[model samples]
Target: MSLEGLNMLWQLVAAVFAGLGAAGVGLILRQLSGKRLPRWIVPALGGLGMIGYQIHYEYAWFDYKQAQLPASAEVVSTETDRMFWRPWTYIVPLTTGFTVLDQSNLVTQEAGEDRLVEFILYRFERQHTDMVSHQTYLLNCDAREMVPLSGDNREPRYAELRHVEGSTPLFQAVCPNA
Candidate 1:
């Protein structure tokens, strides 16, 4: 899948989790308060918490991804700003937010003792009626060349290249601002 697809999937997952959280909170509230709190408030709080977690994950996602990598791996470059969403609100006109790692695609090459990996970042913009999205890949590793391995819908999915011997180090530059 493309990075945009991944971002949308993650957003949907987050929203679902948020909905569940809200319902759970409501359930707890109902159990605690016999009179029952306002019907909307519980859901509102849950939504807020869910969005907050999703935003936090969006910003910290790179770090999380990097931590999963090996210590010898070098991030040559990065991509950013690939997906986004806006939900309606009573107090405001629209609430704009973003999703990232849209393509979830990477290219890796070898450089002697070190391995280089390239990451592609996708971006999406929202208008009143439509969403505009695009993609850019970053050669963010020590490797000189990265080749795409597989993809569909004109989007490169997996890539293969040479990697430096034992260069899979824990990635620190997981997320790069496109």
Candidate 2:
């Protein structure tokens, strides 16, 4: 299992505990209300709260990661959608998939004066179970650029890379030896 898998596992465990805690709260509320609440109401409310919290966490995951990630991290790709079940998502889009690259983990090479950098790409998909895809790439970081290498069937899609601010970290981190 990868770090992301471990993170999701921990979230699942926390959700269960949160559900139970909500049930406990319901019990306390029932007691405070002189048991006017029906026996099933407490369990029902707990279940709803648990599911709501899990949904909220999953929906907020992209924003959470963006906030927590290092400044050197770059969002290479992203997709969003309006989930019908979550009406609020109609106004605010939800990330269904994304790819992020960390500048710190790159290898460098030089073709004469031109610089070439190799690095890994981490792709994430949100679904029934969150999934991660890993690939590698070799980028030529001169005024004109090309991806000389990449893992799997994937090739680099972004051609106007040199103009992006994120490319600064990428070039700096990858071209230190050059």
Candidate 3:
């Protein structure tokens, strides 16, 4: 789905959550206003409820997006950053959500008699240019490395090719799934 569409969906969900939260607060205010509770406490509780709903949606945003992704999609990269809160003094008041640092579609290639499959993830940030590299190997379930390849950045051209022989063409197709 398009980014704009996903964003609109999230906005709608957040609105529903916010409305429910505010309505709950209003109900509680009506119940406690005549009792021992002070009149100022009603608005304070409502404000806190709204803030709580906002925080909940913010933290769940990443998970909601991930759940909507296609099964074939692979999350090759992720990032999280710290955020600050002023008045809300609950725990550290810091929140985190995964930024889809990078994603890729698994492509299978046929080279001569051998088959080459690669998961190529590309990240385009707001910056003019950025690069990333990783070391990959076809290992077994026991965590033994096989035909390890050095990390290489994808710039003007793909770095180097390192191939290892195995009993079958599909070697590293194990639990980890890389």
Candidate 4:
């Protein structure tokens, strides 16, 4: 199984444990109160604990993933959004995704007059299931153009080629000497 799958499985197990623990607390409370607490309180507390754990896990994911990255991986940008379903996000926007540039694997080449740099970009998104995708890119310092390379052959996707500003973090990281 993929790391994400394993993480999800662990999360499910943790939530179940949280619910069980909260239910145990509820049982103890009832016992101490001469059984005056409603019979539904135990299950209600269990459900609350599970939901609380899920919320905390969702909010903590970005920081957890960031801490897992290598030293060479620099976060270029982050995306935040407020979802209608997640009302609390409107108060404090949730980090939905981020882009990381791997500096260690950068390959610089001289193709005649142009300075070409090939690098990998890692994109991480928070969804129902966390997703991570990476793609190889070729950047021409002289032309300030960037293009994604496709497949094992590493052929440039001309259709997706676009201009990149020199001041962007990606450009600065890949073409610092340019």
Q: Name the candidate that leads on lDDT.
A: 4
RMSD of each: 11.8, 5.8, 8.6, 2.9
TM-score ranking, best first: 4, 2, 3, 1
For model 1, how does the per-residue alpha-carbon lDDT over 1-178 read when each residue is reduced to its tens digit?
Answer: 9776787787788877877887788768877897477777677777887887656655565565556445544444444433435332332333232334423455555557656455544333343322434344434344433333234443433455333322322233442321
The per-model lDDT (C-alpha) reads: 0.50, 0.72, 0.46, 0.93
C-alpha lDDT (0 to 100) for residue 65 of candidate 4: 93
Judge candidate 2 at residue 52 and give its lDDT.
72
Clashing pairs in 3: none
**Candidates in descending lDDT order:** 4, 2, 1, 3
Judging by TM-score, tell me the better candidate of 1 and 3.
3
Off-target runs (Cα >4 Å) in candidate 4 are 1-6, 23-43
lDDT, candidate 1, at 88? 26
Candidate 3 per-residue lDDT, tens place, 1-178, comes to 8766686677667766676677677667667766556666656666766677766665564566568556654443355544444344244332332223122333444556444444433332211122233434323323222343344742222243334334332333322343
lDDT of 2 by residue, 4-79 (tens): 6898788888888878888888898899999998898778778977887777886788887678668877876788
TM per model?
A: 0.38, 0.57, 0.48, 0.78
Record all residue pairs in model 2 with backbone atoms less than 3 Å apart, i.e. clashing. none
